[model samples]
Target: MSSSSEEDLLFAVALLANEEEEKRERKVWVHNIYEKRETYGEFHHLFPDLLKDRSKFFHYFRMSQEKFYELLNLVKPCVERENTTFRRAVPCEERLAVCLRFLATGNSFRTLAFSYRLGETSVRRIVYDVCDAVWTKLVPIFMPQPDKEIWERNELEFRERWNFPNCVGAMDGKHVVFDKPANSGSLFYNYKKSFSIVLLALVDANYKFVMVDVGALGKNSDGGIFSNSIFGRKLQQNKLDFPPDKILPGTNELMPHVIVADEAFPLQRNLMRPYPGDESKRNTEKRIYNYRHSRARNTCEDSFGILSKKFRIYQRKMQVSPEHMTKFVLATCVLHNFLREDHPNLLAELIEEATPALQDLRGTGGTYTGSALRIRDRFKDYFSSHAGSVEWQERMINVGRRNTNE
Candidate 1:
């Protein structure tokens, strides 16, 4: 972040040196030579010493150092020690801005180092160390276990809006494209014929990301990824802490709390997925279940889109190694969770406007046409046929109630 910010400042300064600085000075200046060509040059003459001093440039440069510093302080941690080598080596504000720029734009470390006035190795170390410190310090604070109160509030909202109960979060998976690593041709390639990684996430009713699992091979389907994930395993074994198996707040019947997922996941007694079968009756029932299930599950899409669009790192082709890419991804997600919690209104505005029109056109259910009604009827028939099976009927009843409420 520090390096990246410096790069921006350098660009801004370079622009000023060319336009404003050259107009006053009579001599031309070349900032640096690379590949036998002068990279940073001014049209008119300005002494190298004058441009070397940043204060002189800042005297007339349009960039806001204070705003950059203010943003950096919010992201910086107070160093515990007064004399650590890392602390003494870099300025807090500069490093924070560099990291922010890294996330804000997926620029290379070399480019960042030049702009930040730091060694290439230093830039790499700062980014890694700061990212590590942040992940360790902030992930728990921002992404803690969902408390009973939070779950209850979500349940009420789901019941009121989607006819679902005890739905703590909506879970889903999507593929994020990545550059293929050397000699690993088709292994990382997905069904889409693109090199990618799968992102599994769970989000709350408010569309805030609650949990994320990345680094899964893209060949793994959503169900396969979820089934093998730690969260999925915990859910399967009932290892996650849960409330008493009793009715929840403002409801008469026992509230059924679970994560909502798509048909790609397996339907367990505890995990709710759409009914399976190719029969027309079953298909219709599945469609109706999907309609309701999507209402909640779509939050994952919103979360991913917002993170990718806001950070901009995900927008570009990440040039780091696979391991660093994973770290970058996790770090980005954790940071997003923090910003969403700490600066929600700003995040909301960014998300609302970030998605381009073409991207928004892809994910929409045809219209509120008669197809939904047909599925509703099929749902009724399925419930009637499975009347003798108490468990199936109960699940169906929950779906029925959710549909009506929604």
Candidate 2:
């Protein structure tokens, strides 16, 4: 039992371990994909040519390196664990991939992880951490609070083009359906008979989603949805910083600008809706209002459309719980705004051009009416109420006119 014999045995064991490690390394495959699948392929689909110069795309479209590093600094503090139970430690690129996947495809974390190389649990954690970073840093930077001048200009533009003065943005609600929780019954079900969360949003002229509130039960009416929202309260208390004392572009009306929603909201002096009724005459008036309001309100749909188109995840079913959907919606909105800001010219060209002018309206844009106030009332009354008399409807139009004038 000499020393040489013992050393020889130890060396043989070490050599075997080295050979095994080399075999494992040889078996591992890591292929870099420059182009992406049809869905969730922002960098690839929208700007395929840029993939050849990936660095240029990052340089042109992504945030500046300093800002990105700042974002990294914010996220580093939230990583939380030094050692993870998972076999491989999650890298920054992987975490970023989750964020990008959410933005690019709006896919569920489970689906994203399967395609992007990570566990579902890790994907969830990484998405939330990156969201925390973007929500704290990038969101505020990209979505700066609208100033008085911007609001005033928005109102002026609305007045001149749409006959709705002092309108900063349009409000709308969209439903995101999901599987009903056990024993939840009809509670989460909507008119569509599906479990869902309604996403309420305010989008601007540029088709940028500026504000959003998510996680309202699907059963809730759009008005019911908005009433419980923080944005709704802000309007009630006049907390929103609206442009003050402005003349409606074509008319003499003067008032602080407001947000235009559908007939599903309660009438706040600042919120506009169409006239409510069924008589052929009254219906015509309501239609006219809805038409104009739709012109403005349609931006919300456009915002949703662009989001779904880019993320494709929305086209498929969502897999996250109702609560996490909030984060998903918020993150998507931020991403939409980011793309709009970073690639304005591209988006501008991609957006459909304005259609031919409506008849009699003569380029009045789309539609408008007192129907919003009616929706507001219906929502406030929980959707019960006989249609107001035609005379009363006329009076509201008058009041609306006066409100616009004042």
Candidate 3:
């Protein structure tokens, strides 16, 4: 052979040798530390001890041990994986524990992997899978579509607890902040200068989320988001199965069962918002009406506050994709409703810090129907009259004015 041919052969042999060396250096499986997960993992080593202390278990997982097992049973079938000859699959219990711990603390996947003695990639997959399972299994049970009876029950609760006559639920939107996605500019950016997704919810008097519309872009206004949501569409079309109009509790005038919202929502026949402008502040009846409206609408704020306080995932900007973040928020909301049954007074314990008041987002320039305007005026008159007035409403309005003047 010629010298050039011999050199070509030699180069081929050297290239093969380098490839063999690279293959030998590469990791073909997980590290030995992960294989010893049962002996070293927090789920195995620490969770048993946690079960012995109910309070500690609750604090660790943000749910009681009993509730944890109940949730585990519901989600186990979906998250469970069969063992293979290569290795045993991570138990459904451990998968759920990892997911809950991540949500409770909002820790990074790396941090959780170390605690669970699993691969970081494994932790990420487990969290996503388990969150999907939780939402699928629990949403229907905890947040069923309301019927006429359900609407009336909610209305009664609102009247008794909030003293807002003919009210069914309180509606609002919360922004769930997350890292902006690649190749998407200003799509998820909000006025707050953060990238987020909107969680628009209608909450009942007892702080349960009755209906939710998640995964809306953060840049959208609350009114716009509501107008485009399924819940909003149903409400606008009178297909929500709300109860028939009834007489105001102490007045002869008939009124529809309504959802109370802040000024960020449009005024509709069945939706009540505070009257606008300096005139509303100066008019005694409008001031009283606004005060009572605010008192009832606060249930929605308190529900969001309790949810954020308990889950804590919402306290920090999440690092997951918007799709996964939506799953996380929905799962947390399901858990919130589930846990509310066992912890009825949970919201009473947390003191939500006062946030600086934001300018209310006005409704779009669409004209309001005369019927909507009349319904609002009827509520306004009812709230100012002795039949609909609460004893402290006048005092509350006065205090609000005093604060504004100061």
**Which candidate tops lDDT?**
3
Query: What are the lDDT scores of the predictions, listed in order?
Result: 0.58, 0.59, 0.85
Where does the lowest 10-residue lDDT sum fall in candidate 1?
357-366
Candidate 1: tens digits of C-alpha lDDT, residues 283-302 = 54445555556666777667
Clashing pairs in 3: none
- Model 3's C-alpha root-mean-square deviation from the true structure amounts to 3.5
lDDT of 3 by residue, 129-205 (tens): 99999989998899888999989999899899988889999988877887888887999988788888888889999
What is model 2's C-alpha RMSD? 11.4
Determine which window of 10 residues in candidate 3 has minimal summed lDDT: 351-360
Q: Model 2: per-residue lDDT, tens digit, 1-406?
A: 8999999999999999999999887556333331123343332244445445644444333433333444566566555346444234555644654575565545677666656555567678887777766666657766666677767766666555544445788877777666676676676677766677777778787777767777878776655567678887777777777767565333444445668766566556677654454532344355445445666677766777776555544555566667666676676677677666544454443333222110010011122246544443332232112321223434544555577889
In model 1, the Cα lDDT at residue 406 comes to: 97
Sort by TM-score, best first: what order? Answer: 3, 1, 2
Cα shift from native, residue 129, model 3 (Å): 1.0
Give candidate 2's total backbone clashes.
Answer: 26
Best by TM-score: 3
Cα-based TM-score, every candidate: 0.63, 0.63, 0.89
